[model samples]
Target: MNERNRTVVTEFLLLGFGKLHNLRILLFIVFLFIHIMALTGNVLVVVLVVFNQSLHSPMYFFLSQLSLSEILFASNIVPNMLWLILVEGGKVSVDLCIRQFYLLAAATITQCLLLAAMSYDRYVAICRPLHYAIIMTFTRQLQIVIFCWLMGFMLSLIVYIFLDELDFCGPNIINHFYCDIAPVLELSCSDTSSVELATFLESFPVVLIPFMLIIGTYISILRTILKIPSTIGRQKAFSTCSSHLTVVCMYYGTLTSIYIFPPSNNSVDANKGLSLLYTLVTPLVNPLIYSLRNHDIRRTIAKFLGTL
Candidate 1:
């Protein structure tokens, strides 16, 4: 390798949001508001789920986990983004960016597994109502939740460990808001094939498998709902699921576009937009989609707020 390819890079230049820096103050204000809103929305869901006796079910349990993951997910990127936009020459240490990548991946995979768990919970409730309580016991719920977090961390940890093998030379400018795995890989002078392959192997299970499971579960759910004899019963069943489905569609849909789509000659700016969809938009929308459409959550929030 050329000496240039082996020189150690201490820091990376992060071109956040590209030309949007022309309106840096405005963008910072906008993202600050977004960060606050995302935190509030997800935190409220988690708080409601924890404090309210009514939402102490397995579904809400998973929802609370998802909310927490959303908080971490957005936190992994947004604050730094706000900080960078407020400053000139946005940059981060190599160590900091790698850590950020680890946490971001963990948050993302946790949500994916949690969503799958939620889908399974829905399946049990909808298709086998009698066996729901028996199957989704407290031990099982805790096990599933723990598994999601551990699995998420473990997968990202694998990638992080492997990341140490790759070397970044000078000209270490990352053309995106955050240290996204792909763009960061593009900067490495060392062979990233192993890490890329490992990332794909690890990410595939979290992304593809959980998504497949969710789809299968929902298919069964749809069939079960169709078999219901009463229109009101069907409406109630559909209402219970419509929110989750909407969020799932949006979440997985955007992720599929970002991950599964073959990387092209498209500008990094284009890919950043896709990242914004999941990293920013999904977290904010999840609470609105799940809570606003959810009568139980709405009532619980109202009751909790009324006392305060």
Candidate 2:
């Protein structure tokens, strides 16, 4: 390759959503509403957990972490997306693109592991109630959270570093809203076999392993629920798991659609839409789901509100 050919591209044009000039304002207003809801809801969860002494349990600890992760995850994509749609006219620099991709992937992977950890916490709480305190102590939860963040960043960093080195001398238009790996790869001039392989290998544990563990935990939880003799007992158990299950289904469902199916130009567009469900909608729904269904969170919020 010539030196001129090796020159790095400076910026990238995000072909976000579509160029329906007439629909730009409509899209902007819709996204603004979603973004505001996402931020407010997640932040409320964090504040409630922080201020409520009664909610200082292992489960709520993890729940707060998940909310924080969701906030970070949404911020990585939504603000930039809103900027593109409204201010920058849907354009982003190459460095900014890579940074966005890295943050999005890192936050997403962290949430996956955090959910699994929360499930494990629930498993221990339900299946081994007496030992839950010893097993899921503050130190232990901190360790798990730290490990999740570190592992997620390390894995995503490898992919981002490799992608930075790849030549993107072909089409500069990214067909999706944000700087996702699949869409970015489609624009690369150099071969992406290595990057694809790396993504698959690195993403396996981040996705499948945690997914299996969550399923196993829930199965065990369900078996325990069935063994309960009282109707109220079963209902209580179901309520505890329901919100988490709802969030999990919404998140994993969209993620599976994006990854399990092969990425194409059309798939990229579809993926962006699906990404909104988990990245934006799920966060907005999470606090509401937990607050409405989980008695603990509701009580905490009510009590906190009363003090004001």
Candidate 3:
């Protein structure tokens, strides 16, 4: 905390998922497979949405953006993780670590806000069909998407600027696979009370506000679904809402578990695994969930494949 005690760390050693000497090759293969699938699946979705005229709608437009964001998100962490797993000595410089942290934070926050916006779009479609078009116009959708990206960028900038000023002296090992804010903060020699408090304060609103919005939208949607006159109509509406709800639950459940709950002696492993779900598994599942459950997406895929 004092000038005499201050020291700067030039590089960081990542501990990664685990250090099973015998299972390094196996872990590499598993993560490599996931990285490939994440890339291929997300890329296919982006390409399909871009090329297929039939897939161009407010929903798919958002889906395309989500797919692109997921691709960028996974790329920011996974590849470096893979390199660390494979190479004998993979060390990251201080500047590089900060850059990775900035990008990862930016992509993640963007995805969270974008997903929340998409949920609202679905709510308007199912809950207020009459006003759906008026509420979610093309211009308005574009504006929302831009706002999401801008907010994410600004938040990441704030956090990273604070991080840049921190001095990391000795014990340069990061416990997790990627360079996250918390783990990085733990290594700093400087007074991190302000930084830690800022992180917590910023996280509260960013995490909860979008979460509350998504929940409120879905509640309205559920009420509308129940009010449908005929049983068949009710069944159809429920089926439609169920898929989106499932994805939302999986995403928000894991996300909240990681961010909302404080890190405890017993909860670190649980937190890491939950982080994997949102970072690796959720992106892989999003396209499959949408394609399997949504008739329009399935039909569009079929029609697109038929021509190809």
Candidate 4:
């Protein structure tokens, strides 16, 4: 703990499920497939939103941005993760690790707020249909999407600043796939009380606020949906937001499991599995959830595929 005894930590060894030596190849293949599929699905969504005239609503616009965030999120972690999986573990310079941390944090925060924004869009569409056009104007939609990205990057910058101040000495082994804030801070010999405190405070705006907004919007949405007299009408109304709701549940469920109710100290492996769910699985499934459940996306994809 003494500054004089401390040695600068130039790099870190990511201890990605390295113990599964016999299954490394299998893990690599599976993840590679996931990475490819996630990228393709998200990219297809973005293209669908951009080029298609029918998909120009605020909802699909927000969906495209969400796909963009997923692309960044998945790319930031998966390639290096694949390498770590294949090699069992790998060394990364402090600088590269810090970059990865920032990217991952920004993408995650962006997606969280984007989901909240999408929920609000649904609330407006279903609850205040007459005023939806006025409220969700093109300019306002752009502003909202830009604000999400800006907030995400700005909050990440604050976390990075705190992390930069920490002093990491020896024991540069991170027991996860990526440089998550907690695991990275664990290696710090410096007093990380300030960093931890700052992170806790930052979580209010980054995670808590967006989650609360999503909850509030959905509550209103449910009330509106319930008010519709006909069962068929209610079914149609609920179907509109169901895909977004599903994605939100999956997103927050994994997040809450990993960060909120984090596994016990002895269950680090479980933590990794949860991380994999959000990082790889969610992105891969998001497009499927939207396209399969929603008629617009499926119809658009069918039209596009038939032309090929």
Question: Best-fitting candidate, measured by lDDT?
Answer: 4
- C-alpha RMSD (angstroms) for model 4: 1.5
Local distance difference test, candidate 2: 0.83
Residue lDDT tens for model 2, 65-161: 8889888888888877777676535678777888888998899889999989988988998888899888998999899999999988998899888
Ranked by TM-score from best down, the candidates are 4, 1, 2, 3
TM-score per model over all chains: 0.95, 0.93, 0.92, 0.97
Can you write out model 4's per-residue Cα lDDT over 1-308, one digit (the tens) per residue? Answer: 65386589989999998779999999999999989999999999999999999999999999999999999999999999999987889999988898899999999989999999999999999999999999999999999999999999998988888788778887999999998888898888889888788778978887899889989988998998889999999999999999999999999999999888899979999999999998999999999999899999999999999999
lDDT of 1 by residue, 169-244 (tens): 8479877788878778888888998998898788679988999999999999999999999999999998888988
Record all residue pairs in model 2 with backbone atoms less than 3 Å apart, i.e. clashing.
none
Quantify how close model 1 is to the true structure by its C-alpha RMSD in Å. 1.8
Query: Candidate 3 on 173-237: residue-level lDDT in tens?
Result: 87667787777888888888877777777775567788788889988988988888899998887
Give the residue spans of candidate 3 off by over 4 A. 266-270
Clashing pairs in 3: none
Lowest-sum lDDT 10-residue window in model 2? 261-270
Question: lDDT for each of the candidates?
Answer: 0.87, 0.83, 0.80, 0.92
Clashes per model (N, Cα, C within 3 A): 0, 0, 0, 0
